[model samples]
Target: MANSDSGASSNNYSFKVVLLGEGCVGKTSVVLRYVEDKFNERHLTTLQASFLNKKLNIAGRRINLAIWDTAGQERFHALGPIYYRMSNGAILVYDITDEDSFQKVKNWVKELKKMLGSDICLVIAGNKIDLEKQRNVPIEEAEEYAKTVGAKHFQTSAKLNKGIEEMFLDLSQRMIERAQENDLQKASELGRSSSMRRNVVVVDDEQAAETSTSKLTCCGSTT
Candidate 1:
């Protein structure tokens, strides 16, 4: 899974990260910035979930991110759980300029936790950071909510690409560490199972040897 060309030992860690929030919250914009390093100003509402891929190296681990941009309208909410299930992590986005969008973050978090479990890594991203004059959700308030839910918080401007890469990079590092920890746990369990099997085989061999020796001794004594 390591990328040989990067000169650093890179393991290809496939991680799914979904964006959830109310409509027009710049979910797709944030994803496009992270995946393509480009931004579009004419915002279009997302109909279905859109997927994008990006590769990066974090602490020598090659992480491949599968970004899912889900439609935030109420009608499309039924598909929300399906997207959440496939995600190892999530970036819950809200427009900094819109209070209603920001308020819906709690709902998104609730649904995600209900479907994906509390262990799933979640990041609360306050989008449109560039629109400071129109900002309705204060940074402090948004960050406090993020802390309350145990999710990382970021203020990003997709149009400006500010904090976009950093957010994804942070997620990548966390995902890589999680994957490594899980791998180590599995390896340790396998090693223990193998050792137990070996011990059983050795005990059986010793018991068989003792039985053979006992039979020989009996025969010799009788003769």
Candidate 2:
């Protein structure tokens, strides 16, 4: 388990992740729980969006995560793709007690795929899981849908803080891994570029030396 709040370092990497789902499904609540570790019973619905910055360590490397909590109303859905464009990962959430909200998870996924591509890292959350008595979406069904869309699924209770930390931690870890791999690839590319530049410099130096030697020989013959 990596520390979630370690400060960034020279070896640290950062990435952006966004949360998308139907309105009132507790996307803001989940992010508030994960980033602040506090819940507000009277929090207002998110309007445009909110941003939170968190640091995480994965496999001994520090990584920074910028989380975007997006508004989920149908009217706000138009803005979802912009967030998706800049995100390296996403969390799709829905209310467990609302069948319509649960169904909208598929729509969110579809939009994300259409805009961001299928390989985007994603987690599917069934929120308000504490209201099991009122659950209109079955656990198996949600799990199946998550699997179908290749997203990780979890049941969470933002009110009780159940599964809240775990969900974000899991998503953070996945994002960290992706960031680490990306950093490694970039470092390799830079190394190759540097080596190629050095080779070019060496070749230029050799050519310059040859040209100087030829000039000297021609002057000597003329003299």
Candidate 3:
């Protein structure tokens, strides 16, 4: 990928992803499992929203993921835009045992689409699969909804560390492909005749932050 104002380098890419869902849906647990490879038996409530960084080398490309875990409580819902406004992707998590949480994920999907449009990649995760016996959301139903929304679906068990790694990796790959396509489009446009050329500055909240540090600064947050 060509280096641009968006903080993408020749071999390095930085992407910001946010977790959205209702409280106690294991959003924090999912992030912890992917970024730290650890899980907390006791539930931890997020205050507002915080992010953590994970570095990966896939096919000789350096990918840096800034995963933002937001507070899912109803009271903090109004602050969601602050965290996800310029994110590259999103992970909508819901507990398999909670039907209401699944519905909440739909609401989040609508909000994200309305704000960020289809440019943002999305992944829908039905978490807490360890309690499969207590599952209220059927796998087929979730998968169908994900397909309808152009999002990939996964059944994740954060406690057991199942599907978490694959979920992040899949989302990252999708983001990388999207970014590369965008870069190609920009290059093609710039190659056009000089008569159509125009100067414009592209500025974004997340882009400015990413440009400050390659792959973004590493940070840690508990759920």
Among these predicted structures, which one has the highest lDDT? 3
Pairs that collide in candidate 2 are none
**Predictions ranked by lDDT, top down?**
3, 1, 2
The 10-residue segment of model 2 with minimum total lDDT is: 1-10
Once model 1 is optimally superposed onto the true structure by TM-score, how far is the C-alpha of residue 46 displaced, in angstroms?
0.9
Clashing residue pairs found in predicted model 1: 1-12, 2-10
The digit string of per-residue lDDT tens for model 1 on 1-223 reads 2112222133666788888999999998888877777788798789978888888766666667778889999999888878778577889999998999988899988887887675578899999888999999989999998999989999999888899888988877776665666666667899999989888844588899999999999999999
Q: Rate the local accuracy (lDDT) of all candidates.
A: 0.81, 0.80, 0.88
Error of 2 at 28 (Å): 1.1
- By lDDT, the better pick of 1 and 2 is 1
Return whichever of 2 and 3 wins on lDDT: 3
Clashes of each: 2, 0, 0
lDDT of 1 at 143: 90
Backbone clash pairs in model 2 (N, Cα, C under 3 Å; residues 3+ apart or in different chains), count: 0
- Model 3 per-residue lDDT at 87: 87
